[model samples]
Target: MMPMTITEIAEAVGGTVTAPFAGEHAGGVPDGEVARSATSDSRLVGEGGVFVAIKGERVDGHDYVAGLGAKGAAAAIVDHAVSDADVTQIVVDDTVEALGALARHNIERRRADAGKPFTLVALTGSVGKTTTKDLLKSLLSTLDETVAPVGSFNNEIGLPLTALTVNADTRYFVAEMGANHVGEIARLTTIAPPDIAIVLKVGVAHLGEFGSVERIAQAKSEIVRGLLPSGTAVLNADDAHVAAMRSIAPADVVWFGIDPAHADEDALTVRELTTDDMDHPSFTLVAANGDTADVRLAIPGAHNAMNALAASTVAHMLGMPLDDIARVLGEQRRISPHRMAVSTVERDGAVFTLIDDSFNANPDSMRAGLDGLARWGAGRKTQPYRVAVLGAMLELGGDEQGLHRSIGAYAAELGLDRIVAVGSATDAEFDALAGALAEGACTAIASRGGTAAVDWVHDADEADRLVTSIASEHPGTVALLKGSHASGLSTLAERWAPADPARR
Candidate 1:
């Protein structure tokens, strides 16, 4: 973050200075005492960093402000001043809003720096936003310094905290915008407006909150609407809802997708797209200018082909060559945790491939993950025992049961050897949703003449026992873990494939 004095920060956030450090002046902190960064998490606060004390239901950040001086913190932004603490305090009505203001001030300072101007690229979607953000970060970093969020930090507080991390030498800021409502993305846009905006897809991830897919489309379009007048919009041409955004875009739009029907001379499209046995996509990245490069993504999933193309489009717009884009893309072997993350697991002398896509789930992403599983099984020399341990996909509106069942049917239709629908043992509602999934799979199996086994377990423990049983019986087995965050399947995935601490 650009350095800002305590007085400048308090003025930026409309806050009052209180609880000045003992060594500091009574009126205010001196100009030499400045905060170099901003963070809401007290544990992550560094010396010379400004801590934003946000009050949450479980934890009140104001409680930690009194100790900032001992940690060498420059100051604390809180709703109420902590008189006990020796650190400088900027008292405000709302610390979250103050953090946003500080971030906005930091970004404006960077933009006005003249010597080091940075391009801010923002993206939003129902799915693939983080994966695409990681891809774009990788591609952009190959050219110059880039800053992006840690994970799915795309909300109000997350976006601002990410924006504040930008410094003078940072050449690119890849902001991932996410919202369950119509105005959330627009609100975030006010904090860090993008020079180039991207809309990945308009799917049904947050159908319950937004009410309809059309409303979700409208919510996703805010990124394009929030772009600077001279900015560029990178949109997915494959999704009809996303494609329609071109009509409402505030600036020139650049299209990227796998579909040729939506492509024009200026759009980037994929050709001869295909995924390997592990679901790694290899495609010809074709540009509007006739420049082409063969891109073989190391990440697992055919769905990522569009994501890669979207990142390539942004890099291309930023003057990166197609060869460089392809090279950077191919070098990315992983993304944020638990999204189509592939690993090996051994249980009772049996081994299997684990596709840990348990980060979060929706109908679109579930189907995409199942497709990857089907391809992984089909590509093997010998047929591997395929099992899909699916948990309930939440926030799907009133048709939540139908959505769960449809996912089950999709796995059955894919000829998976086993379908385990997992739900909470203690939660009756989630158990019913899992039952619906199993019922759909059972119906599909009975009618389709497949020997697939469908079972609805109460929780991840039961699902793990069943998968381990299958692993013991079959030496070559492949398991897919897909679920919403509430389903807790990600925990099971972590147990199955614990992250390598050396790499972390």
Candidate 2:
């Protein structure tokens, strides 16, 4: 963040300085009294940091204003004034709006100071935004000082906080934009308009909120509409919904896809796609200029190959040679947690493979994860028994039950050795839907005379117990835990794969 005095901050956010220097002010807050960083969490406040007090569902940050002085905060931006704390206060009508205002000011300042104006690249999609953003950050950092969010920080609050982190030396700003409704992304574009926009795929991840696939497509395309006049739109040519966005983009369009049939002469295409025993995809990356490179990803999933192509297209446009782009992508490992994170655990003389893709789930991501697990199990020398401990995919709307059942049936069809559906067994309100998911898989398996077993558990504890028992009985068992945020599958993964002391 750029250094700004309390006076400058007040001017930027339309706030007033109220304490410590309210009456002692020599015209305005001293230029030396500056905040070097901004945060909404008081616990993260450092010396010379400005704390913005935001009221959340459970905790009101205004309640912590009295303690900022002890924590070395330079000033507090609050909706109300605090009398007890011996700290400078910037009183604004709304802290969130003030935060956006300050972020816009910082971005404008950085652009004016940059010798080469920093490029803003924004991406939105149903499933691959975070993973693709991580890949882009890794590739861009090889060429310039890049600023991208930590993990899944794509919403309103997270986006502005990320934008504010940019400074004069920052050359690339990669913003991951996400939305649950129609106008969310459009509002975000007003904060940090993109010079380049990427639309990965239009899927059913937020079907509940938007109500239909068409509405979801409309929400995702807001980023492209928000692009600058001279911006570049990098689109996924394979997705019909995403491909249609070319008509509305007000800038030059570049395409990336795995299927050659979807590619035009100017598109980056992937050919001869194949996965290794661990399910890591390798393919020939053919760029727009016909320069080709053999690319293999360290991440374990065939789905990630498409994400790699999206990142590679962005890197190629930014002047990274095709060979260098492939090398950087091939060397990159998992940057974010709980997305295709593979680990081994030894317990009671039994070794198990844990594929934890439990960060968030929808029908599309769930299918990709299951496919990766099936492939991985088939390629193992010992023929590891595959178990899927999946939680309910939330916010699927009126067809939620049907979608869950379809996912369950799909798992059975994959010939997985076992399936465990996680949900609240005791909660009468949730049992119907959760039970349907379990019954759907069991019925499908029985109908096909498949040997795969199905189990339904109320919570993560029961799911973990069942998985441990299966691993004990079958030493080479491999399990995939995929679920939405409410399922708490990520907590279970941490229990199974705690950090190793030797590696630490």
Candidate 3:
């Protein structure tokens, strides 16, 4: 963060500074005393950095303030000052709000510096926010210093912490915005407004929280509405819900998609979109002004083409050539963990392929994972046995069962060798959802006279046993683990694919 004194930070957040150390002045620390960075976790506190003491559900950060000084922290921002803490304390009504205030102050300071101004790009969508951010960060960094969140740090606290990482040398700040309800992104946009906004596909990831798909689209469009008049809006033309957002866009719109039918007069388009045996894509990247380059993605899924195009559009807007954009895209092999990560496991003299996409799942991402698995199996020379070990997808509103059933039917339609539905045995509601998925596949297989097998396991342990049995029987098996984080599938994936580079 741009250096700010304890007095300046307290003033920006409307807080009171108290308990100046023995060597400090009477009115807080000296004017030269400042914090270089900010963090909510006390364990991450560094020398000359400020710590925000947040009160979470179980551990209150205020308890950790006593040890901040020994860790070389400059000061602590707390909701209430710790009595015996040696460090200077800035007391506020809420520590989370104070962190946001400090981040906003840091951004304003960078904008005010004429010699070191940075452009901020903000993006939000239901499924691909993190993946798109990762791709965009690599492309933007080719030009100059770029700051982006480490993972899916797109919520209130996450966005602010990422914004505070910007300093004088930073040229681009990629902000990934996420929301569970209406107006959440609007609140975040207020913290760090974007010079370019990207609106990816609006799916039903949070359908339960927002009540309807229309409401979900409304929430995603806030980024476009939040953009300044001079800014640009990079939109996906493939999704009708996202395409409809153009009507409400507050700035210039740039379209990007795979279909020529959806392309605007001068939109970014793709051709010959094909994937290899590992599901990596080789496509021709077409620019708005007729410039084209061949892009062969190192990432596993063909679905990532949209993500790559979105990132490339922003890079092109920033004056990067199409050839450079394609080259950078081909070099990004692995992204944040559990999103189309591929690995091989050896067990009892048998080797099998494991596609661990169990980080989180919604209907849209679930289908994409299944599609990738199908392509991987089809591309094999020997036609390997494919298995989909899927758990319940959460937060799908009243029709959650129907959605689960559809996913099961989709797996069966893909002709996967086996479908294993997994859920907690103790939780009847979740277990029933898993059963519905298995039942759907069973019915579909029966109707088509297909011999595909289906099973419903009680939990991840049961899934492991069943999968191990199948792998021992079928050595060339390819298995996929896809589900919401609550299902414990990602933990199972980590245990099996511990050496996968994406998880690291």
TM-score of each: 0.97, 0.95, 0.96
Best by TM-score: 1
Ranking by TM-score: 1, 3, 2
TM-score of 3: 0.96
Please report, in order, the local distance difference test score of every candidate based on alpha carbons.
Answer: 0.87, 0.86, 0.87
Candidate 3 lDDT tens digits, 317-371: 8889999999999899778888887778775566678888998999999999999
Between prediction 1 and prediction 2, which has the larger TM-score?
1
Per-residue error for 61 in candidate 3, Å, reads: 1.1
* Model 1 ranges off by over 4 Å: 21-31, 499-504
lDDT of 2: 0.86
Clashes of each: 0, 0, 0
The sequence of per-residue lDDT tens digits that candidate 2 reaches over residues 325-379 is: 8899888776688898888876556678888899999999999999998888566
